[model samples]
Target: MSRPMEKTEILHPSLQEVHQSVDTTRPGSLWKKIFAFFGPAYLVSVGYMDPGNWATDLAGGSQYGYTLLWVLLMSNLMAVLLQTLSARLGIVRGRDLAQANREMYPSALNFILYLLAEVAIAACDLAEVLGMAIGLQLLFQIPLLTGVLITALDTLLILFLQRWKIRRLELFIISLISIIGISLFIELWMARPHPIEIASGFIPHLPDEAALYIAVGIIGATVMPHNLYLHSALVQTRKIHRDEAGIRRALKLNFLDSFIALNLAFLVNAALLVLAAAVFFHSGHTEVAEIQDAYHLLEPLLGNHLAPILFGIALIASGQSSTITGTMAGQIVMEGYLQLRINPMLRRFITRMLAIIPAVILISIAGEHAVGQLLILSQVILSMQLSFAIIPLIYFVSDRQTMGKFALSTPIKMLAWLVAIVLIYLNVRMVVEQISGYIIQSDSIIGKISAIAGGAGFMILLLITWLYPIRRKSLVQKGYHLHKPQTPTPVMPIHPYHKIALALDFSEKDHAILAHAFAQGNPNTEYLLIHVVESVSARILGKQSFDQESQQDQQQLAAYVRMFEEKNLKAKGVLAYHRRGKEIARIVNEEQADLLIMGGHGHRGMKDLIYGETVNYVRHHVHIPVLIV
Candidate 1:
């Protein structure tokens, strides 16, 4: 007898394989369990310590001399709390933040949220690309534009690593993070910052307007909008039991993972600030606002030749590590909100290109100063989008209908709201201050008009985002339904078919296709099950035939046929050894299928553009009506 499929078995197709690769059933020590849940938080932690954070932290430390350290600490605390909520949303509800938003909100609202999220991602990527280029310039004496082009090639590296193992990718990121930590620790030792002053820096203080501007930048850089979405999706990587105890265990382990990783990130950020304060500020280089400026000063100020080299190395590591995670976050966001999946390679290229073009253009026109200003502007843009993500996250996690028993406790809920309110206020104030400053400084009448119009337009958008109804009135009014379990229903085809052809990939999505196909099946219909085994590798290796591969595919197809036969349905299986896309098209033609039904991963953006989807190829190749389940 076949085991019944659990709801938890359904996952985003791209992540399904890596989801829960750890052994949940094995009786293991606490350390083993901790190890299993360790990867996601570290991936997210990279964003916190990325090159974007560096610009803000360096600026804060050099200009304010550790007075803004409290902002970093506060931001890290906010990250810890929000990330815990994000992980719980994924583990308990089986939905990433984007998916949850899609399910909960109307299309119009979701579209607005999607656009804001994209802007945040682009801003992040801009900082990363700019930082990497600067690092390359500092280290190899390469031209900035040339280095920007070189950074785009990292997309190929990202694609290669993704095809490897998820664990390998995680370890690679962790290793880079370790390099960053060690590099900064050595710098901290060399700088010899006062322990008492460092401790006092932890106490919150805003000395003036300039301090406030840097503090907001620090907050924006620290609690990233994309990381919230990325963490929610990444936690779903670990496959855990969907039962009560399983969720509780996963949540505990996930929170611990977030806590440890975020603290490490906090330390790295603090170290950057402390090093800047001790070495740069004390030496009267308080105006060192740019990474390039910092690099040029590090060697002379510290009197060690290695100081500048280490800084360059750490900057490159930060940019590259952050780039990889930013790409993944882009994939997750597109798939979850838009139900669109694309080739990971193309997705990386598209996002990287978007960031590269403007950066290169600005750098070429304005030169080096533009890079620092752009990096800071990117963080500010991220801060503006931060509330859009946070508000939805808090809303979904607090709803009893959404989180069930895992709904936030009363005090926690209050705390989350307080955080949300504070972030919203900070973002608004930052925008107001920027426009007001522009108005005061502008000598032209046109400049004042532009500032007034931009400020007004931005405020209107924020008002709409806040007032837009995300939940249905009845759902909101009904409040928490602690006892009821909400199960999403699958939409099935309404029209009956005389003949149907189904494509199988033997992936986790195979069962979902089967369920949808069976839902549309009847006694009168003839069902054809087709599985194709590609011999590209065999051909590459100079082998004529893949007998073992063909045999395995045949067996799997037969099992599927048997499963259908036991249900008393007229079904037959076909195993073909050929290329995936071409062979599937041929079968659809030869079998004379009236309606072709198959599973689709629904890739979007550059992935869809660069590497065309098989479903798309098949649709164009054949004349039969097709339905992608």
Candidate 2:
């Protein structure tokens, strides 16, 4: 007889595809929806107060004073424009900006944009590390390097927090925002200036050459690149139902959300600039690099107690709040572009090390001045990176295929293109300035040619990046399955009251399986960890006599118990039971374990009889959840 028609089993769709299929709805409570909308922007706000921003704000205030306040407004306006587009793209398209860029561009163009993005993120990370170091310097008098090393421990701590619910993370962020707001507000109030002069500062006016750099600094601090990426990703976290009504409400609420949060960000940034302008601008201090200068200057005017505490709080909040956002941004980039799945701790470590290593090496060799230069350089790099992302954002939003009925109006598209062109031109000019001054003598003809060429090449590259997605059909297909509908899964909640017992045979495979399960499982539920101490392998099985074996078994059990306790696992006990005598199912039955998870492979002999020595035996006997890894 012909072999029963052999057919390949249909493969299950990936978990990600399934997740995307789920429908989202606007929250019933307007307040809750408003709160959720503000969630992602906080990450963006960190860029405004990071150590790099501190450096620029101090430099600008001390040099140009209130005259440069207009730049802060311009840049914040720029940020609102770009970030709003990013948010709209996310809600309407069901994709973050980075992922959108990747799908739309060619392989070569996508890779370049990806490389720049990685560098931009790394720059943000460096600023975060330095900010943390500054915080340590203020709080504990620790050296920057030591403080940098201590940051590694924070990754593990952050990972631990991931076990908690998402709402808890939101609460933590809100608390940080409150701290940052209070600290900055007090500092601004301390630096009281003439109301007329402050008002004129907000009005547009060009200052001297010395003030130009400060104006640039204020602009740099406001229009940060990572904030754009962050806002896009954050808007996607909402559960907005796909219908027109839900989508429209999400748009309205999100715009309101951006308007409120970004306005506050503007106020905080303005406070930093004002404090600097009022205190240092009038004092003939044109170049202040360290955050300490802000405090020292204030000491004679605002008294010792308020000044020191204010700067210290600002520094601490700047570092801590930015670190959380930087870490999350790394997660989004890796997952978005590479489609790589990584735990939060591992991703944080990788991103932190990359950002810190270069910073430490450069700081050690070049000192604080070099670190300050790196901060400015990071912003320049951000401007260059922004052009690549912005062009695509404008194009995609205008495209009927992606935006559907929500495609941009002609005026909006025109405005977006105008913004893109201006950003490209400004970025190009900055690159030319850097090349002429740093790469060659500013007066040399060769330097001028190189600078012009550099600017031209950069603009060309950006144009290519924008055109790439429109040209590559194959990549578009492979990179994103845009029309795939998300499937809904029944929410199955494991009761916290239900006790679970897990049995492992001391194999690496079993340990790996348990780790995966734990990462995917709810932490609220209680679980018992058990390591069976049977004489299974030759290396460990026959090495000891009966008394020695029992002692070894006891020791092993104790160690495992301690390990679980340290990891915050709800391990009940580690019992030394021989598989030779006790049935695995029978033991689970006695212990009243609602679920049984064990190694898939088992050895023959009394092991099979007592332990249901193999998975088959246990399956036959246990009427419980048996997960064989």
Candidate 3:
């Protein structure tokens, strides 16, 4: 077959607007280039220390008094390993976890995995919403109901932030992470725990089943499923050369990136558990599972008002930073699995609403105190979905046919399997314990049926994914993977363009665009010159628009057609009045053009926000080849 379109380009790309958008190939000092790979992991790091993590950390520390610090260390190590593998997949295969799954797994299985992924994102988003709302309440004395409602506005923040560069978004997340780290440091400084006890806590001792549960929680909260999907896609933001040497360099640098960012996340989490151990567990008040209670207890117990204020600030930062990343992860999985794209603002709104509606109902019916349990429940829900993401990721990166020279070696693959087994066991154990508790103690038959049915379905899914066979030999022959055995690209039949679409504006640059279109075909080609009238009247009135600007646009188009006729070329002029990008896409489809030629406005940064990036919009919506001059 003629070389099929690159898998990423087959349908669409992951985070297409920012895909390979950041430049890492520029000549620079090694450290400068290393720093370019740093931001994606930092964004992934926030998920490790999100609000979901706080509940577990605080609970682990306050109840066990730093005894589970080893668990925190263990979980962070797992996070680093899995995240590195994720980045490896993206860097080498140019496919996120979701997209890779789409190609490798059957469609029915893929759909189920997609639903599981969405549920995971929604659960994570719930924690963020609750965390931010609670932080606002603790710091500003805003009522919890009002604070929860206020959290909805962060979707608007997402809309505003999506307009800027990916690096800008990363910088914003890093700033928030710094705030959280500093706040934790200040809290730790004020509550001085015994150094020996803190050191002894890393001995891997678990006092009881309660300690085990908390340990598993720390792991679940740390090794998030959504972050795996996010990291795989986010690493693609940096443009890296695809040669072996460059691939090795990128793998090395991304490991460093994961090490630094995840360890920072570990520090933030360790501080949370340790802070609770010192201020609450050691002080004999061990019931500080609730964040608000922890905030209240901090000021009195630590004898400083700034402690609570800083705590609240850190909480807000954590929620805000994580909510942003969560939204991006939602986008990745949706686009990667479903193979469709939606407005960022709309996705944000939908994800946020899924969280908010439940939070509001719980608070209204049971009171704000119930939110603490809800946070824990969300993490438990996430735990159920974690294995599905992790198991497939390990399998993908482990396949020699799938990953080629970058495939995980036997030793590393075994180790990755080890980590997978550990996490899967811990998550399953915790899920069983939680579900069993409800089954035995609760009276609701609906809850019982839901628990049993969901567990059975999850187990069935686990078996299906794990046992799903891969036809490695067939895959290699088909050249479906980046690393399969090489064959010469088949020189297939060539088809010249009979009709070409040229997207233009009545600017001096139009000449350059027209030149490129002519280069594609001679006078035999039927040229369709298309321009979108974007005036106020045109935007509101469509074809009926009779404003002066629209009339002038018509005249300009007619003149272009006349010029083409004078040049002994067949040409037709099409004028559309509406959303420029969609209108152009519609006319291109209607005209059955095989090739599309347009000019890049070279709009970057804030200029893109005002003038809009119609090029990206149109490219995604159209099926034709786009040649941007």
Residue 528 lDDT in candidate 3:
96
User: What is the overall TM-score of model 3 with all chains considered together?
Assistant: 0.78
How does residue 236 of candidate 1 score in lDDT?
75
lDDT string for model 2 (354-453, tens) is: 8778877877887755756666776677666767667777776677665666668889888877877766666666666676576565667777777678
Residues 153-263 of candidate 1: C-alpha lDDT, one tens digit per residue: 898678667765677888999999999999999999999999998888889879998898888878877899999898887887787777778878989999999999999
State which candidate has the highest TM-score: 3
* Superposition error at 597 for model 2 (Å): 3.2
TM-score for each predicted model, relative to the true structure: 0.76, 0.74, 0.78
**Sorted by TM-score, highest first, which candidate order results?**
3, 1, 2
Over 249-270, each residue of candidate 3 has an lDDT whose tens digit, in order, gives: 9899999999999999999999
Which residue window of length 10 is worst by lDDT in model 1? 474-483
lDDT ranking of the models: 3, 1, 2
Candidate 1 TM-score to native: 0.76
